[model samples]
Each structure stands twice: as structure tokens, then as C-alpha cells.
Target chain A: MQVELQLFATLRKYAPDQPLDKGLVMNVEPPLTVSILLEKAGVPLDKVKIIMVNNRHAGFDQELAAGDRVAAFPPVAGG
Target chain B: MTERYARQLNLPHWTPETQQHLAAARVLVVGAGGLGSAVLPYLVAAGIGLTGIVEDDRVDLTNLQRQVLYDTQDIGVPKAEAASRRLAALNPDVEIRSHRTRLEPGNAAAILAGYDLVVDCTDNSAARELLNRTCLNLEKPWIHAAVSEYFGQVTTLLPGGPCWQCLSGTGAPADPPPAGILGPVAGLIGSVQATEALKQLTGTGRLLVERLLVWDALLPGWAEFSYRRNPDCWACGRG
Candidate 1:
């Protein structure tokens, strides 16, 4: 299965080669979860604030399907 | 100057009735900092009836980069006072109230009660949490915006939508206040807050309800995720 990985804010530095907003395409095995996906992208788990697959609030352990657009955001609390 | 809102009124759906709703609306802006600087002027200039400002800190030289409502000589002055003075000049027809204090548990209810809606431009976790819970109890709608570096997020929290707790399981990012902000990033997010405020008052556009709109200047695009009312939300949840 192939999934699109999007890393936002400071997390973007991890996937520097990925195009902006378009995300990176990664070939992954089945039964992949959000946590494992982030680990595969080299995005630190501690820095993750919100995780979503195809724009819905999601959990780290949630199972992923092919073509899932996964996004991770850091806490963005500044004005 | 005869037609102050001639431009906005010319928009396809804008009408005199919408302008009237805007004229009668009362809005409270918490934190007269970067985002506040961007939001207050628009609200005042757009002719909102009453605009209240809650900002306790005095302006520092450092804030001038993004807090455009203040100037060099105005650095020592209170942000609420400085911003109010500037906003008043921008449009003297509107009422601008300045509350030169932080919004806390002791004062949040009383302050928020007077306004129809609140705008969260505060940078700290405490102000965000206080505004979130207080608005819930007071039954008011609010627009939330936050920024750091090249990234920012904006959302509208209505009476029945997901409360802050549901979206922000943690009150804020675990890190401390981000010291660096690209001035335009703050301005961009605040502009969305101001636009949301106008829509909420006039019922003119599809409000950003139940959506967290995120933008990163580096990626230079917007991505939003829809969320629902968390039945287990600590504030508005059924559980």
C-alpha cells in the first residue's frame, strides 16, 4: 500500500525532500498505524501534536489504508 | 467618505441589512498583541458597534514588528490604550472600549458577558483555556487563531460545535511560547479571525464551524480538517 505523508511546522524539516502540501508518497506494508507511519518518516513522536488521515481527527494507533493522506502537526499556540 | 462600507456592500451577497447587523454587533478581542493588532482595526473600520479590548501588558519595543497597532513612542503605554486610540482614529463612528487587564477566571465572565462574540488573539495557554471555557458557559461564539513562525491555525467555535478541549487535548503546544513569529504570518491568521467575526455577525458567509484551518507559509497552502462535537468533551461533551 502507498500512503501520502505530510509533516507540518517543525516536522517538515524531517521530510525535506517532500513537496510542500503535496506530501511524500511512501510504500508501506498493510496494518500500518499512524505512529508507525511517523516513525517511518523519521518524524519524532514526542513533537507530534495532532494527527489526521484525510483530514479527520485520528489516533496514533488507528489503522491506515492505501492512499491515506496522513498529516502531523505540532502544537501551534502563538498569536 | 459618505459611503464608508461602499466596497463590502458591493459584494454579491452583501446588503444594507447585513451592514445593519454589523453595526449592531458587539465584539470582544482578548489580547491586543500581534493578532489583536490585525483584528481590531478591521472590526473598528468595518463599523462594528462596540469593540472591547482586553490587554493588560504594556507595549514593548519588540512588539512593533507584528503588533502594528503600536508605535515607537507608544511602547510604554498599555496595549489596550494604545490600540484603542489608533482604532478610534481609524473610525470615530464606532465605540472602542479598552480593558487594560488580562482576562482571568476572576474577570472573564464579567468581561465576556457584555459582548455577543469573542476573538481569541491571546498567545498564552491560560488565556486560550479561560476564553474557551468562559465562552462555553456564557453561550457565546468565538473565533480562535494562533501563530508561530510561518505556521498558523484558525477555527470558529460555536455553541454546538467541538469545544476547544475536544480539538486541543492539550491546552496548547507542550513547548513554551514561540518567541519568533513572521509578522505576516500573524497578520494572515488574524485577518481570517476578523473575517470570521464579520461573517458570524452578519450571517453573510459559510462560517468555519467545526473545522481547524491550518496554514504554513513554507508550504504556502492551507489544509483544514473537520471535527465534530466530542460527546466526551470536558466542556461541551454529553458525557
Candidate 2:
């Protein structure tokens, strides 16, 4: 299965090679979860404060389907 | 209507009726920091009937960069008081009230009662959650916005609609270190929040409810992602 992965704010550091606006495509095995995908994509799970799967809020255990769009955002606490 | 709102009333979509709606609207802006600096001025200028500013923090030297509601001489002054004074000077026709305290669970409901809408301009997750729950319980609409670096996110949560917990879950993330931010970034998001509040109040345009609008200064573009209310969401779910 392939998923489109986008990282926001400081989470972009995890994917330094990818463009900021364009997400990368990840080919993973079946039944991939958000936590597993982040680990595979080199994003530290602790740094992610919000997760969206196909634009819907998702949990770490959320299972991703093929061609799903996933976005992870770092904690942005500043005013 | 007075000449003060003549320009807005002249707009194609707004009329004396819209101006009256604005004058009858009451809104509570929960923070007097950077985002509040942007949110309060526009609401007051738009002639909201009663604008409540809730901020417990005193002005600090480091706040002048983006907290536009204060001045260099206002250091050590309570933000709510300072913001109220400044807003009053901008539009004396609008009533400005100051709540010189934080929005904690203990007093959140009382402070939020009697307001038609709320704008969550606080920087921390705890306050955001508190506002979400209180607004949800009260069945009121609230706009949430946050800024860091060059990125900002804005969303309007209608009662019984998707909420902050639906996006981030029940746990509050630990606060990140003080990050660098451009002054205009906050101004931009704050302005967007104010626009959403106006639209919600006067029924001018489509609301941002159920959509998360993310602005990246780097991309200089907006990306909107849609979300649904979680059936199991502790804040607004049926369960």
C-alpha cells in the first residue's frame, strides 16, 4: 500500500528531503498504523501533537488504507 | 447607523441590517496575547455590542512584537485592562469589558455565559481544551486559532460539531519551547479569526466550521482540511 505523508512545522525536519508543500509517497505493508508509519518515515512520535488521516483527526492506532493522505503537525503552543 | 460604519455598510454584502447585527453581537476573546491583539481590534472596530477580553497575564517587555494591543509604557499592566482601554479609544460606541483572569475549568462556564460566541486566542493546549468543553456544553460557537513560527491554524467549532478534541484527542501535548515567530504571522491568523467571527455573527459568508484552515507563510498559501465530529469524542460525542 502507498500513502501520502505530509509533515508540518518542526515535523518537517523528519523529512528533510521532501518539499514543504508537497508530501512524500510511502510504500508500506498492509494494515499500517499511524505510529508505525511515523516511525518508518523517521518522525519521532513524541513530537507529533496532531494527526490527520485523510484529513480527519486520527489516533496513533489508526489504520491507513492505500493512497490515504496523512498529516502530522508538531505542537505549536506559541501565541 | 453612524458614519463610523458607513464604509462597511457600503459594502455590497453588508447593509444597515448587518451593522445592527454586529452591534447586537457579544463576543468573548479569551486571550490578550498576540492573537488577541489582532482579534480584539477588528471586533471592536466592527462595532460588536459587547466585547469581553479575558487575560490574567501582565504585559511583558517581550510581548510588543506581536501583541499589538499594548504599548511600550504598558509593561506590567494587565492585558485585559490595557486592551479594553485601547479598544474603547478605538470605538466608544462598542462596550468593552475586561476579565482580568485566566479561563480555568473552575470559572470557564460563568465567564463564558451570556456571550454569543468565543474566540480562543490562548497559546496553550489546556486553555484551548477548557474553552472547547465549555463552549460545547453551552452550545455556543467558538473560533480557535494558534500561531508559531510562520504557520497558523484556524477553525470554527460549532456546538455539536467537530471540536479540538476531535483533532488532537483528549490529552494535551506538553508545551513546546518558546519558538520564534514573525509578528505578521500572528496578525494574519488573528485577522482571519476576526473575519470568521464576523461572518458567524452577521451571517455574511460560509463559516470555517468542520474545516481546519492552515496558513503557511513559507508557502504563502492556505491548505484547508475537513474533519468530522468523532462519535467517541469526549468533548462533543454522543458517548
Q: For each candidate, what TM-score against the reference?
A: 0.94, 0.94
> Which lDDT tens digits does candidate 2 get at residues B1-239?
47899889888899888899999999999998889899999999999999998899999999998898899999998888888889999999989998888888899999999799999899888888789888888888999999898889999988877888887762356878888888998999999999999999988789998898988887677888877888987777865
What residue runs in model 1 are displaced by over 4 Å at the alpha carbon? Answer: B170-173
Model 1 Cα shift for residue B12 (angstroms): 2.9
Q: Which docking category, incorrect, acceptable, medium or high, applies to candidate 2?
A: medium
Tens-place lDDT per residue, model 1, A1-79, is 9999988777777988999758999999988999899899998787787787899987788899999999888777788
lDDT of candidates 1 onward, in order: 0.87, 0.88
TM-score of chain A of each: 0.94, 0.95
For model 1 chain A, the run of ten residues with the poorest summed lDDT: A43-52
- Provide the RMSD of all predictions against the true structure, rounded to 1 decimal: 1.9, 1.8
Clashing pairs in 1: A78-B147
**Residue A16 Cα positional deviation in candidate 1, in Å, after optimal superposition:** 3.5
Report the CAPRI category for model 1. Answer: medium
Candidate 1 per-residue lDDT, tens place, B1-239, comes to 33998998888888888888888899999988899989999999999999999988999999999988899999798888888889999999989998988898999999999999999999976778889899999989999998888889999999867887787762234765565899989999999999999988988779999899988898788889987777877767754
